[model samples]
Target: MIDKLAWIRIENGAILTARSHNRDTYYIPGGKREPGESDHEALLREIKEELSVDLILETVHLVGQFEAQAHGKPAGTLVRMRCYAADYHGQLAPAAEIEEMVWLTYADRAKVSAVAQLIFDSIHQAGLLK
Candidate 1:
């Protein structure tokens, strides 16, 4: 299983997502934790690296944990995604391996990873997403 972290940035009823270089589907902006890194530390680092923005540490909160068969991976491979909600400073921009950044609504569900689709469903059910 691949463990990953993600930042759930909601604005104007949409969630921020990223599409990596040469990737077709988008993902919530975050990445796997480095060796010996805590979730917050990893999340902050990944977000800054991928989105070119500094996450407000004090504003970070766990949104949920989700698991699904890893997208585009071989059968039996799984991905466990730990998602968080946070406020950030600086303008959002695509960086590093990220090719594009987008704000997606419920209608854009099919454009994201499977676990991300679950995250969208949960947020929509909570009436937090459009």
Candidate 2:
């Protein structure tokens, strides 16, 4: 299993997301933690590297944990996604190796990752997409 963390930055009713370099599906920003790193530390570093913005750790609110088949990978390799919502600073810019940064709404679930699609659906059903 691959452990992951992610965050949805809400702005003007839109959610910040990233598209992979070779794929169209969008995903929330965050990545795996290095050895010895805490969840907050990993999330903070990954977000900054991927989005070019420093995240305020205190703004983080635990959302929900999710598990799904890892996209484009082995069937049994699952991704356990720990999610959060948080505030951030600086302009919303895609950085480092990020291919594209996009804003998505509930209606855009079809263009998201396998796990994210489920999360999006849940958010919509619970009236949290807006």
Clashing pairs in 2: none
Q: What shift in Å separates residue 36 of candidate 1 from its native position after superposition?
A: 0.8
What candidate 2 gets wrong by more than 4 Å, as runs, is none
Q: Any residue pairs clashing in model 1, and if so which? A: none
**lDDT of all predictions, in order shown?**
0.94, 0.85
lDDT of 2 by residue, 1-130 (tens): 8899998776666678897677767898999999999999999999999988888878988888888898888878888899988888877688877899988898787788888887787777777676
Question: Residues 45-82, candidate 1, lDDT per residue (tens digit)?
Answer: 99999999999999999999999888899988999999
Model 1, stretches more than 4 Å misplaced?
A: none
Judged by lDDT, which candidate is best?
1
**TM-scores for the candidates:** 0.98, 0.93
Instruction: Rate residue 38 of model 2 by lDDT.
Output: 92
